[model samples]
Target: MRLSTILRGGIVVACTAFASGTALAEDLAFTLKNATGVAVTEFYLSPSNVNNWEENLLGNDTLSAGDSIQVTVADGRATCVYDIKTVFKDGSNVDDRAINLCELGSYTVHE
Candidate 1:
């Protein structure tokens, strides 16, 4: 099910940036910690085998350094592994491959 966008403290948070009240058994929910010492301006995920990254999960929001947010990936796909991409406020970005979301309860973006 698609969740409605949420606004908290004046920031627009999309479903991928935060978990809904309930979770599906197939959904992958995990805590995203920002440890890169820079604000994260966007987050994107696509199945590991996919060539293109999905849309930004943050919408108009940003994840500041040392902050954490619960993120949920519910794209209706059976796959559990994904390629992660995060863009920082300074325009630099990081790309990671083959992250098994179902087995990962938490992910930290650092360095």
Candidate 2:
């Protein structure tokens, strides 16, 4: 009986750790830019990882010309998908020019 209990407990702990590791797990930085040469009162940055978009980086709703907003993800992951947008400045859109500051980090699990 004691052995069975120990085994069950061990399995539960392992599963819990795995589940927690995958929950909202990601890491990256985002920056928004204004390519319209105008002040964007509302701006946003949408970022996503391999198969998750909702959990990605979502930016604010406002930004000025030449101004940018930044956020860092903590899971230490990189995403190739991102969007920069103008939230509510009239004559603006979700499209904007951007310069990637640095390459995304590599996955530790793959290597």
Candidate 3:
């Protein structure tokens, strides 16, 4: 009986470990494209539930029209849903919310 119990316990532990590993491995990554007529001057991504916006993901670089950039979502405390903000060279901006980064492979900005 003890041997059988040990075997069942091992199986449970293995299954739990595998489940957690799979969740961690499912990291989110995608591409952001500037399809608008003007250049994109800024980009920001934040958790959908948060009020404070994070830093500019683009840093010092600008995304010109028809260009694209890869974005890897790695926020330690982030959820699957995110908010995307983009600013254009003309100072126009867009703020979109409830985007599922886990399921999104690409996002395009248009005028």
Candidate 4:
């Protein structure tokens, strides 16, 4: 299975599919773009499921408008919807959004 890539704003942000000519572990590249008006001082990424509340997978980065970040997810996992939020240093809130990853056509994740 040849992996295909999606370009976002001139960035080759992620590659889709498991591998070329065969199945393999899948991984997702969680890409975040600060398109909001305010600059986000912190952010969090977590799975939508699990009862432990919104756990933070990444944070503590000062991101300006148009700035972006990416994280890779382990492969062989099925598609899962995720929650993403941005927080300011002063405790102000920016936004909370959801996107699906791991499933084909969603954000690709490879192990």
Candidate 5:
């Protein structure tokens, strides 16, 4: 299915009919878009109040520029606010703080 994208700023949240089909507590999933013109070697989302980065969401997969992936929070953390961290293949990293994952349908990361 083709999902509509939300373009606001560096961190965007889409509001489409497909996105509202899931329940927040049962399915904490969101789309992650890569637009940094680089391969994302790692992706992480940690609770806003947490001090350390969570496990790599991408695992062994790499997200190239213009690509997107579905990220699901199955660890049982129900917090809407999170800090995102993306590590590029060139050993570079970018961090976006205090993003509401619950309200976010799709998050597009831009350079």
Candidate 6:
């Protein structure tokens, strides 16, 4: 009976850990709106601690003025802060850093 109780307790602990890990690793979906007057030709989302930016999140797509795109923020781990960079069609670009993406369901880029 003691052995059975120990096994059950271990199983419960393992299941709890698994559930919490899954929750942290889950992806959060959000929308990005281009409030800039120009069209955004490229968009990148990278970790705050990373120096190099990731690949363009928008593949063959442009976010025009007042347009919004749905984006999934996932880095395969528990990371909430992110850096966002956007390149406009006119060759101008802007970068915003340290955004708490986990708490945001939508973001708007301006100017």
Against the reference, the lDDT scores of all candidates come to 0.74, 0.37, 0.69, 0.47, 0.72, 0.71
Tens-place lDDT digits, model 6, residues 25-56: 56656778888789988888877998998788
Tell me the TM-score of each prediction against the true structure.
0.75, 0.39, 0.72, 0.50, 0.74, 0.75
lDDT for each residue of candidate 2 in 1-111, tens digit (9 for 90 to 100): 001100000112346557777543344544444444555553333453223223212233334454444444444334445444444455534443332424532111000
Q: After superposition, how far is residue 107 of candidate 4 from its true place, in Å?
A: 9.4
Best by lDDT: 1
- How much does candidate 2 score in TM-score? 0.39
In model 2, how large is the Cα lDDT of residue 81? 51
Residue-level lDDT tens digits of model 5 in 1-111: 222432221222335324876443444678888877888887788888989986777766688888887776655445778899989988988899999978878788876
lDDT of 3 by residue, 12-70 (tens): 23475577774333345677778888988878877788797878777666788887776
- TM-score, candidate 5, is 0.74
lDDT (tens digit, per residue) of candidate 4 on 1-111: 111222121122234333444444445665555565556664554566633324333343465555555555553444466665667545676433356654423332111
Local accuracy of candidate 1 as per-residue lDDT tens digits, 35-102: 87899888887889889977888888888888888886655566778898999999999988999877
Residue 36 C-alpha lDDT in model 5: 76
Q: For model 2, which pairs clash?
A: 26-75, 27-77, 42-61, 42-62, 42-87, 43-61, 43-62, 85-94
Among all windows of ten consecutive residues in candidate 1, which has the lowest summed lDDT? 1-10
Best by TM-score: 1
Candidates 3 and 6 compared by lDDT, better number = 6
